[model samples]
Target: MFSFGLLNLFQLFFLACFCEPAHALAPGSSRVELFKRQNSTVPFEENNGT
Candidate 1:
């Protein structure tokens, strides 16, 4: 029982370590995608205006 608990703790620790970076980057990546989309649309708008 104690070993099982220890194993669960280790798994949780590893999961947190692995997920931390992905979770941290998720927002930044989404922001970059939004920025890219905005930049791409600006050219289209200007072309339409011309």
Candidate 2:
């Protein structure tokens, strides 16, 4: 019974480690999209200037 509890704890730990990065990556991808949009628009503004 104690070993089962330990196994569950380890599973939870591994799940947390994997899920933590995926959660962070969700926002990280949005941040990258915003950065890409800013970069893409800067060229449009420059083209308008010319």
Backbone clash total for model 2 is 0
Instruction: List where candidate 2 sits over 4 angstroms from the true fold.
Output: 27-50
lDDT of 2 by residue, 1-50 (tens): 99999999999999999997686568547666666678884643433655
TM match of model 1 to true structure: 0.49
**Cα lDDT over the full model 2:** 0.75
Q: At residue 18, give the lDDT of candidate 2.
A: 97
Report, for every candidate in turn, its global Cα lDDT versus the true structure.
0.75, 0.75
Candidate 1 per-residue lDDT, tens place, 1-42, comes to 999999999999999999977865686576666676788846
Candidate 2: clashing pairs of residues: none
Worst-scoring 10-residue span by lDDT in model 2 = 41-50
